[model samples]
Target chain A: MQKVVKSFGANTVLNALDLDIAKGEIVSLIGPSGSGKSTLLRCINLLEPIDDGEIWFGGIDISVPGYDPNPVRRRIGMVFQSYNLFPHMSVMENICLAPVRVLGRKANDTKAQALALLEQFGLADKAKSYPDQLSGGQQQRVAIVRALTIEPEVLLLDEITSALDPELVGEVLDAVRNLRNTGMTVVLATHEMSFAREISDTVCMLDGGVIIEKGSPESIFTNATNPRTRQFLSRVNSR
Target chain B: MIATVSTLAVAITLIVAIPKMPRWDRVKKSFFNGEVLGETFPKLLDAFVLDIKIFLWSVPIILFIAMLVAVTRNSRSPALFPLRILAVVYVDVMRGVPVLLWIYLIGFGVPGLGLERPWNSPLLWGTVALVLTYATYVSEVFRAGIESVHESQRAAARSLGLSNAQTMRHVVLPQAVRRVIPPLMNDMVSLQKDVALVSLIGPIEILRQAGIDKSKFASFTPYVGAAIIFLAITIPMTRTTDWLLERERRRTSGTRVS
Candidate 1:
């Protein structure tokens, strides 16, 4: 999202935010609550409309006013803070739902791929279990695989582990770390600074709906240029 | 009056206690003899036939009209608010009035208005009245079910590359229907009972047959017999409703377990 502006009535959540994520980079967005990190992620998939901006995914100008977003959204998979797995569907069905319905893939083909994804996430045993039957971390991991089953080019993670218990957070982050190894492009909105510094190729600090600082993980962690970034990091690291 | 009540009590007790009572056998013999009593059996059968005809014809038509009303009420188009208000008014008016009045109004009043001539057949008039009155109620039931699905589900579906209609058909409706099945079943049971109101229009339903037999015999046995048949049908339905409610509770609790 570049020069994107989104306001609810008069309160601007994203103002002239400019960002360019590379083809296969894991970029972590860190900020205090209500800093528009979530809104920025929402705009990339056009879940939330940007008042004035350009979002270019691959070669597609997704921000073209009045353009249909269904095709664009199909290529951009998003994981939510709440996991958002369909409770009525089993883990395997949740993974296969989009592929069979939207993509019109054969049932056998979708099932095979869904099972493989479940196995890859170490959730093969939970194929028949519904979302509510799984732990918070397990549900989040399944949610990630659910998005990936559609073969999206960009995966948006909106604080995917924030809703999990502290003990369960590691399992979800580990699943994400495994995805990072595959070189999938990821834009993560997160609060776990250690995980962010460890896995992210680049980190962007946002405050009051604008990017206040941006750099490599090492630079941002050890020597933040902005006083706000330093103070934010200090408080985060202390906890 | 006291003597009549005492006689009814003794007859009921004998019928209840003695499964093979000769008095019941005598009534059965008279019914099979193809005389006045014989007419009761065929009349009851005809009533059942009429009930089936009403259900088969009316349910689909009601469902189609209800679908249109539900979709209009839920959609965000320019006509949404007016459509919603119209549906609400329809439900309120139809539900508030007795079904019998609506039946009379549609059967007698519509043809008097110089609209298309009313259906000449009593069966047709009854079916039409049932469909018109129940469609409004069922439409509201459908609307409530559709609205019960969480808004977040819609958002999630939209983000998953589904169009607005697709989201409604696939994600929203399935979940909503699951949630509202018990209430919907209750409405259907009530509709089945309401079929008896067709007797008011001179169609020979079970109650009408019972009434004719009662007037001819000058006895209350036909009324008791009809009550027994109605109970036989509805008791199982009531049991099914209990089972459905329990199943839903279990499913919801299971979902919240983790």
Candidate 2:
């Protein structure tokens, strides 16, 4: 994606932000709250229309006015912090819904794939369970499964573990680790500093809608860095 | 035991006091006599069937129209601006006007416009007025339901490449409809009673049939019979609404495992 701008009324959440991720690379966006990490992910997914600038994905500039976002959105799956699963639908149905309806795939084929994903995620028994019936970690894992079922070119996760309990966070992070192992390109906004250091190919520290520092985790976390990045890391580490 | 005794005492007191009331004799002749009640019962019951028919047919159509209006009005698309305005106008006008006036305007006044047979039928016009009026109220309930769904659900669905309509149908509306079931049922109960207003337009429904019988027999028994019929249908529905609301509260209040 190119330099993207997004605003809500007077608040400019993303200000001419530019970032690029190559295929099979995992990029983690780390930032303080209101620092535009989530907004950046949303812009990349086209969930939020950019106020200015362009987002080019798969040879198409989706930021143009009147351009259909649905086709591109299908190629870029996103999961939310709140585990926004359809509470009324079962886990299996939730995973199969977009594949069957939006992709126009056969129901049996989609169901088979959904069940396979469920089995792979250790949620095979939960395929018949409603979201409300699942624990927070389980629900977040299901949310990721739902996004992954569409076989997106890039997966964007916005603080997927933010709402999970400390004990539950590991299970959800494990699922993300598995996704990365399959060579899936991923862009994520997160507070999981250690997890990002362990799995991310590159870490970008965003402050006030711009990437203040970008490098390998070892350099950013331990070695010399920009003063703001150091101060931010110290604040997070202290907590 | 005390509650039971208090209830029985109130009932016994009412029974004993009935004969001593100044209008007892006339009340007996007008509302209690077996002959008047028996004579009016079947006819009022028959007319009540008309009320039920109108209610049955109008409710589904009203709900369908109300869903359309609510969805349209909730849209933020600039392209749907005119449609949204029209929906807002329909809800406002229909809700602002009394059902009686609507029945009069549609049933009596519209015929003066030289409309043909179906349009001139009092039954059809009366049904139309009820549909127009109730659709507005039901649409407001539906709008509340739709708005109550969280924004994250929409974002989640849209992120998966579901179109706006698809998201609403699969993710948003099912949850919204479940949340609004009790309120919708409340509107339905009110609709059941409001159908009686259509009687003013000469459709010969329950209350109108009772009026005719009362004038012919010089008795009020037929009105009591009509009241009984309406109670039979509405009381159970009201109870069901309460039961549904209680169930929803319980389900929502249950603690989620962290």
Candidate 3:
């Protein structure tokens, strides 16, 4: 994304923000609430249209006016803070919905793939269960599996663990860690400073809709030079 | 023992007081004359078939119209602004007008417009009027159900590469329809009764037949007979709606044992 601009009436949420992600890289966005981290992620996925900028992905401009985002969205997966599982559907149905309907995959083939993905996530037993029947942690895992079933090139995770209990957060984080091991290109917005420190190839600290500081996690976390970065880190560390 | 004695006392007192009630004989002759009731029951039941037919045919059309109106009203696209306005205007106008008036206007007024043969048919016009009126109310129910779904569900479906229509079909509407079933069913019950309104337009439904019988016999027993037929149909429908709603509640609440 180059110079992406997004505004809500008077409040400019993403102000000419530019970001580039290499294949198989894990980039983490850390910021205070309302700092535009989620907005940036949404813009990348074409969930929000940019006012003035170009987003080049897979050698095409996705932000072009009236561009059909569905095709591009197929290549980008996103997981929300709340596990927005289709409550009316079972886990397997939720997992298979996009694959069979959007991708036009055969139903039986997609069901097999969905079941395999569930087995891989240690949720094989939950295939028949509704979302409300599962724990928050398990539901979040199903959400990840739902996204992965599409085999997206880039995965956007917006505060995926923020709504989970402290104990359940670890399992969701571990799922992200496992995705990183498989070399999926992931960009996540998080408050988990230590997890970002451990997993992110690049940590971008956003403030007021701009990337104020970007570097390796060690430099950004410990030897940060920017005053605002230092202040934000200090406040977070104090907590 | 006390509960049984009190219940018996109430029953005995009501039985003893029945004959002494004011105008009892007149009331019995008017409402419950055996000969009039025997003559009225079958005709009312037979004529009620038309009511059932109207309800059956109008329901699907009403639901389809409601869904379309609700979706149009809920749209956020700038291009759909005109359509949204039209939907809002339609719902407001239809809901504000008395349904009986709609029946009269459509039934009589359309025929006067010198339209085609089908449009001139009072029965068809009556059906259309009922659908238009009831759909306005049902659309609001649909809109409430659709909006009640969390925004995150839309976000999730969109992020999965589903188009807006696809998302609505696979994710949003299924949940919305499930949530709105009880209210929708309640509307259907009201709709069943509203079918009687169409009788004013010359379709010989139960109430119209009862009126004919009352004029012929100079007794109100046929009207009571019509009321019984309406209750017979409506009571089962009401109970079915309640049972379905309770079952849905139990299933979603995870309180179902098996």
Q: For every model in order, what is the number of clashing pairs?
A: 0, 0, 0
Cα TM-score per model: 0.84, 0.93, 0.92
For residues A177-217, what per-residue lDDT tens digits would candidate 3 score against the true structure?
A: 88887779999999989878988999999999889999999
Per residue, candidate 3 scores C-alpha lDDT tens digits across B53-136 of: 999999999999999999999887899999999999999999998999999998888888898876688989988999999999
Q: TM-score of the second chain in each model? A: 0.74, 0.87, 0.90
Model 3 residue B187 CA deviation (Å) reads: 1.7
lDDT of the structure predicted as candidate 3: 0.91
Q: Which structure is stronger by TM-score: 1 or 2?
A: 2
For residues B80-136, write the lDDT of model 2, one tens digit per residue.
999999999999999998888999888787777888887778778878888989999
B109: Cα error in model 1, Å = 3.7
Tell me how each candidate scores on DockQ against the true complex: 0.38, 0.59, 0.61
Residue range A1-239, candidate 2, lDDT tens digits: 66777889999888788888888899999989999999898888778889888888877788998889899988999999888998878788899999998999999999888888888778989888878778888898899889998999899989988888888677766777888878899998999898788878899999888888898888889973699889888999999
Report the C-alpha lDDT of model 1 over B1-258, residue by residue, as the tens digit: 999999999999987877577586666644333354444655665666666567667778987887787777788756478877887777778778878888887766655565543446555676678887888888778888899887767767777787878888878887776777777777777877788887887778788888888788765566666655667777798788888777755653354334
Q: Which ten residues in a row have the lowest lDDT in candidate 1 chain B?
A: B30-39
Model number with the top TM-score:
2
